[model samples]
Each structure stands twice: as structure tokens, then as C-alpha cells.
Target: MFDKYLIDVATLRNTGPADAPTGFAFEAKLGYYRGLGLSMIEKLDVSIDGEQLPREAVRFDEGNGPLSLDEMETAYDRRWPFGTPATILIERPGGFPPGEHELSLLQQLRVSYLPFPSTNSDAKSVSFPG
Candidate 1:
């Protein structure tokens, strides 16, 4: 229901040094009104310019440090606070070539009281930092 706000399109950028970028990154917000532990996030599917990214190619970070998607499954110690954006990283050797690219994310978040996880989808055309 709150999928449109899942990604902060304005914060898209290449991560690591510009010349040797390790990947691209962008700020992401939770669809839920309140925050939950990283473990609550069940699935995160990302695609760039129409290509689906491998599960191993994406990472999540909340500023303190970066964690693999698998690691996040057990990251009970990590809290994604409400209204705060988390960084989503995609591993791409050169990142985007300074152009606008279609970025999309589909996430399944588990709400403890619900029988099924909440699914959120967001897509946008964002420019890489020049």
C-alpha cells in the first residue's frame, strides 16, 4: 500500500570512488509507518534498467555498516527506525554511466501480527550523480 515511498529517488548515487565505483546506492524508506528490525524484511528484489539483480549482488546498510541480504535475515540487533531512510546498495563494477536508469524494488516485510508479509513495490527513473 505504501510502495511508492519505498525508495528515495533523489538520493540515488554511485557508491565508492567515482572512478572505480563498486556499485550504485540509494536511500530507501520502509513502507510501514513504524520501524521494525531488519529481520522483519523477508524479501528484497531489485532490478536496474530492466535487468534483475542477483540476490548476492545487493546489500543493505543503516549507516553503521553494510550487511548482505542474507545477513539481514538474522539482524535482530539492527533497527530501521521510522522516518529514517536506509541505504540500498547494488554491486556493479562501474555503476551507472552517468545517466538516468530505471530502478525498481519489491520488498516483502513481515508484520508480526499479520498472517502474511506486506508486499511493497517501487520503481523510478533516477539519475546517477554526475
Candidate 2:
């Protein structure tokens, strides 16, 4: 989440082979807010099917390098904002089976006027039942 805003997942897709560099392309947005500054994300954690993906696997479409969960700051300019229609790419070496899975994202956010950072985490599972 970005401050009080929620980065929600609208769509999830597996566009690669199961054994290849496979992962989900999630289309997300900052709920209720128009947008957020680029540096607002202090740390981000991603997990698929309960397996935590490395920090190097997550990439924002507008950023040059991958995001680090331990990093204290962003490398891009603050002018670039993130909001709805943002596509986030998360890749793993060996992908999940062709079935239901749980996808979750925990984000530590930074606010300009706040004395301390905020925590915004969300989790949702994808289930297809017969």
C-alpha cells in the first residue's frame, strides 16, 4: 500500500512456462488516490503460493532496476508517480503449477510529513474450484 492508499490487484496472469522464468503480471492501482510519488515505497515483499520471491524478481514498469526490500530509498525521481494501471512484473525461476495459488504483497510505505513510516499489507488467493 502507498500511505493510506491500497495497491490492489486487478488481474493476474502467468505468461511463461512453469519451469522457465515464470511469474504473474499483476495490474495494480492505488485505491482511492489518484497517484503517489515514486519514492513513497520504502520496502516491498512479494509471495506466491506461500513462497517468498526474492527482491530481485519484482520490477516496477517505470523503474530502471529491481526493488530491494532492505533498501531505505528509491533510485528514481519523485516526480514520477505510481497509481492505477500500473503493471508489476514478478518472476521466479521455477514457477507454480497450473492451478490455484495464493499471492500476497506487503509494502512498507513512507510519508513526507509523518514521523514514521507506515505499513500496508494485503493478501489474496486465486482459487479455481470444480
Candidate 2 deviant stretches above 4 angstroms: 1-10, 17-21, 31-34, 62-75, 78-83, 128-130
Question: What would the C-alpha RMSD of candidate 1 be, to one decimal place?
Answer: 1.6
Q: Which stretches of candidate 1 lie over 4 Å from their true place?
A: none
Query: Among these predicted structures, which one has the highest TM-score?
Result: 1
The count of residue-pair clashes in candidate 2 stands at: 0
lDDT of 1 by residue, 3-72 (tens): 8888888888887896798888889988888898999988888898888889999899887799998999
The per-residue C-alpha lDDT of model 2 at residue 121 equals: 62
Residue 6, candidate 2: Cα error in Å is: 4.6
Alpha-carbon lDDT, every model? 0.86, 0.57
Per-candidate TM-score against the hidden true structure: 0.89, 0.67
Instruction: Write one digit per residue (lDDT tens) for candidate 2, span 1-130.
Output: 2533333444666547644636666655443233455567766677877777888777665344444433325554532344645556777544434457676776666667779976666677666221
Give lDDT: candidate 2, residue 4. 34
